[model samples]
Target: MTTLKSGDKAPDFEGVNQDGKKVGLQDFSGKKLILYFYPKDNTPGCTAESCNLNDNYNAWLEKGYEVLGVSPDSVESHRKFKEKFNLEFDLLADTEKEILQAYGAWGEKNMYGKKYMGVLRTTFVIDENGVIEDVFKKVKTKDHTNQILKSLNI
Candidate 1:
């Protein structure tokens, strides 16, 4: 779960996208950003969540929001995932986990009673000025876009 809350200043991050292009918080200055962190690329839940965002990407863009997905996957993996799914936004490659940790997205996860450190599925809605507008810690994969839109009242 994320410790960040609404009205908090979103932590700045710099990482490479699927195309190996450097992406940083400053790159989205004056723009609302949907920075979502997930466990892995090409997984079932992750794919569902990403596809939901992808399917509604134009709506988000029309609402003046840009989407960026992050995970501890390599650039090549992200590239393949984006290509396979025809994702319309950038997918950041956080193989080093630096960006994930900064957003409190990387932590211990329990699955089948097995505990291990990994990325926690979380979404941070950042305003135009970089302040967090909302933090969705328990995201519903299939309805994530609706959740975000409702939170923003858009």
Candidate 2:
């Protein structure tokens, strides 16, 4: 499948949030959506990124953006991760890898000379009209939220 690019339509997905509520792209229609895909939950890098977003959650909201994280983890696992980190945003459970594949976040990844299929750390900034405004691939965990904020001119 072709990876999504700027101006591409963001894929619609149905995922359960940390609060066990179903959240989909349609639910965020008419609003800017910061949809990010990560490798796993509770890991150091993932935790840092999630926490950073949490810390600036209010600011993001003020700027009219909704932060949504997706990973190939179960809803229960997402709940634990969010509760552990006190994350205030929605973390979607993409257990089936459907959303991952649809968004082009699932693909080959290399670490220490070993290549394996996994989620490629990526972030998509969807515009209010549901079109992708920007795409950040192979994102660095640290200061990523700030980087996105800067890129969005927020």
Candidate 3:
């Protein structure tokens, strides 16, 4: 769905987080960023992916990486989801799908033989300079942290 490739410059984005704080690309200028776009909040797959990241949050931090989740859900929804799951990362509220579109994570999808436009689960590993280091289109929700670590050869 996304035209963004491994070496492309990650598109600049700004959105409100669960705490209603404005967050943007510039906020993480000198750190490796794990930007994951999921279809919705609290869904089974989404939860698994997020929880795995939360469980390994310190590992990521120790490896110099920061994680951020994005979805078209509202801030209130994000807040509830984060609290329920005890998520340790910021979940961006992209209600308008602006950031999703910029990253090419919003696109048509098929399920149960029905086609509709929705968010494509994707993860972009961005370097300190904001250049994409790797793209994970086939994300393994249950083992996402290990997947990322393997990608980074950590």
Q: Pick the candidate with the highest lDDT.
A: 3
lDDT tens digits, residue span 79-130, model 3: 9999999999999999999999999999999999999999999999999999
lDDT of 2 by residue, 67-136 (tens): 9999998899999998888888889999899999999899987899999999888899999989999999
Model 3 gets an lDDT of: 0.95
lDDT (Cα) of model 1: 0.93
TM-score of each: 0.96, 0.95, 0.98
Identify the runs in model 3 with alpha carbons over 4 angstroms from their true place: none
* Global lDDT scores for all candidate models: 0.93, 0.89, 0.95
Candidate 1 least-lDDT 10 residues: 1-10
Candidate closest to the true structure, highest TM-score: 3
TM-score result, candidate 2: 0.95
* Clashing residue pairs found in predicted model 3: none
Error of 2 at 89 (Å): 1.0
Over the full model, what C-alpha lDDT does candidate 2 score relative to the true structure?
Answer: 0.89
lDDT of 1 by residue, 25-70 (tens): 9999999999999998888999999999999999889989999999
Quote the lDDT for 131 in model 3: 99
